[model samples]
Structures are given as structure tokens and as C-alpha cells.
Target: MTLSVRRARTNDVPSIHQLLDYYAARGQLLPRSPDELTEHISSFTVINEADNLTGCAALEVFTEDLGEVRSLAVRDAATGGGYGRALVEEIEHNARTIGLRRLMALTYVPDFFARLGYGVVAMNTLPEKVFGVCVTCPKFRCCDEIAVLKHLD
Candidate 1:
């Protein structure tokens, strides 16, 4: 695979939204609004193959020691090719570079994150994301997503 990860530009927002929507529609991820995407564009990294965006992920820093990996999605055609892992690795590197002590993700694919060094943790363990975002999420009252965290050195 010639896929490469890079910081997203403003123009990439639409494509990133589309990719996330593709997964959201199928219940693979939560759909984010264009406004939110634009607001957090700098936190994103896209997997590009040639001129196409094959997958995307975002690193949302909550505190000095923590960043959450959210909005991860791989195009259906590109699934099973390690793009998801690549995206998370990219985010993990970003977290480490910024001196975060832990990288977390709330996901339906815990095993995938586990393979990438994340461990299942209690939902309440991440109070920042939980109280900051989950309280407003539709699934907040009955969230089924698994929370995973990877400690950084």
C-alpha cells in the first residue's frame, strides 16, 4: 500500500466528513458536523493514496496528559489494509510529541485498538471526554462503545 498519513488541510474537511459519515451511516462511527470538522481540522490526519483519502482520524487533546483519538474511519474498499492502524499510530505519535501521557479512544472496535496497544478501561476513567462530550451524545445514556487507553512513555 502506498498510503501515507499527513496533516489535513482546510479543503480536506469535506472529504473527512464524508469518510466519517460513511462509517456513521453504517454505525461504525459517530457522524460529525462540517462545522466541527472545520473547527478541529488541525487535529486530523488523513490516509492518502495518490490523491484520494482512504481513511481518517483525529487527535483531540483534552488535558496536558491526554488526547482522545476519535473520528477514525477507513473506506470500505480500504478495510483490512492496516489504514486504521496507520491512522491511530499517527495520532499516537502526535500525542507523544505533544507530551501527552495517555492516548484514549472510545470505539466499537476494541480489539483493533487493543492490537495497537490500547487496553480496555472504564468509561468513567476519562472524565474529560465523558463529561465534555458523551453527556451530549445520543448514546450517552446507553453508550455501548468500549473505552480504550494506551499509556505513553
Candidate 2:
């Protein structure tokens, strides 16, 4: 199957929410409602082979130069097929297009990001994420996700 990544559209919300819920239920990613996905659809990128949605990710800009890679997930059957990497590459492209100089992700799979040039970083180093966003996360006090960052050219 040929996979291609592109900007998300309004009609993709249900599929995106389902894909996110699949990982969220396994505690591999955060859960996002269909409404939330729809509201931020412009920030998302999706990978599909023909009409089947395989993976998705979003670039959440926090500042003029900083953005976070959020809600990255791939279909269980599609994992290891490079769709995840494609989705993130799309996100990085989107971030750079918007003039972001840095991209960060809070992930359980730091190695995946590392393969894409991300480096491990302390959560506290990102106050915009720590105070502005983490404070609202249910796992804030017991967060186990590692923070990873990459500098964009």
C-alpha cells in the first residue's frame, strides 16, 4: 500500500478521534474528543493509503519559535510501516513552514523521536508546556512521558 501524508480535513475528525482513542485506551497517547479534533483540525496532519486513514499528528505552536508535536498515533496494523515517521515528518514540515525554530514532544517512545533527530530534554526546560499545558493534564503529578526536542533550520 502506498502511504501519503497531508493536512487534515474536517471530514477526517471521526477517524482521527478513533485512532487516538485506540492508543489512549492503552495509555500510549492522550485522548482527544471528536469535537476537540475538529476544533484543531488545521493543526493536524494525516497519513492515508487511498481512502484509509493510517496515522495522524498535530503541531501545536506555543510561541513564535516553539511548537509541540501532539497526538501522534498510527493504526495498530500500520505500525512499523513508516506511517508514524511520515506523519511526524509532515508535522516538522508544517512547523517549519510556520517559522517555528524548535519542535518538542512528550512521548513514551523517545527512541522514535531520536531516530528523527530529537534529543531528550527535561520537562521543566519548557515552561510554556509545563505551566501552560501540563498543569491541565491528568497525569501531571505522575507524568511518565519523556520530553524530546529538535531544532529546526
- The 0-to-1 C-alpha lDDT of every candidate, in the order given, reads 0.91, 0.92
How much lDDT does candidate 1 score? 0.91
Clash pairs for candidate 2: none
- Residue-wise C-alpha lDDT for candidate 1, range 9-39, written one tens digit per residue: 9999899988888888898798899999999
TM-score of each: 0.95, 0.97
Per-residue lDDT over 1-153 for candidate 2, one digit per residue giving the tens place of the 0 to 100 score: 666788899999999999999899999999999888999999999988889998899999999999999999989997898888888888888888879999999999999999999999999999999999899999999999999999998
RMSD to the hidden true structure, all candidates: 1.1, 0.9
Off by over 4 Å in 1: none
